[model samples]
Target: MFKGLGGLGDMTKMLSAAKEMQSKMAQLQEEMDNMTVTGEAGAGMVKATANAKGKVKALDIAPSIFSAQDKEVVEDLILAAISNAQDKAQAKAAEEMQKMAAEMGLPADMKLPF
Candidate 1:
């Protein structure tokens, strides 16, 4: 109740909104850490799992490609899978941010502090 304080009321409102946004962001970060995305390569022989925060959580490799001659190929597959997982994680995070922005009545193109 910043009555008669002119701009003080606006500043108080702004501070309250900023604080609410900060709290929402913290909650979103926690949710992103729990959400996961999976990427696969070599026809599903290699799979990588990562959180929406872009941290790799687990990797799965099929045993059929473990031969000596296929070592390089296996490595390539692993790299590809990891890259794909990271990409998906980024996209997922962006999508979630966009949803949050829309829910908060922000412009769709407004960039959030991620």
Candidate 2:
């Protein structure tokens, strides 16, 4: 409605769009916290679940993998599962962000702050 304000109109429009995008981003962040991915290692002897935000939620280890002499092997499997879970979480987060950007009419490759 700033018809007579010249450039102010464009600035106002830009600010409004930015505000809307910020709101959408916040909502997406909340969604990511609830979204989860699972990763496994050592032929599924160890598994880790993490949220899209890269926070580990739960871990599962096969009882057969637990042994006194194989302690180090079990530890390695746990670490590998955790790392895989984190990697998947990061990829999922990026995919979600790209989808969001596309929905917002922005370039799919446009990176948004995580």
Report the lDDT tens digits of candidate 2 across residue range 1-114.
Answer: 767889887899999999989999999999999999998999998999999999999999999888899999999999999999999999999999999898889986689863
TM-scores of all candidate predictions against the true structure: 0.93, 0.93
Candidate 1 lDDT tens digits, 1-114: 756789888899999988888999999999999999999999999999999988999999999889999999999999999999999999999999999888888899998874
RMSD of each: 2.3, 2.3
lDDT for each candidate structure: 0.93, 0.93
Cα lDDT of candidate 2 equals: 0.93
Candidate 1 similarity to native, TM-score: 0.93
RMSD of 1: 2.3
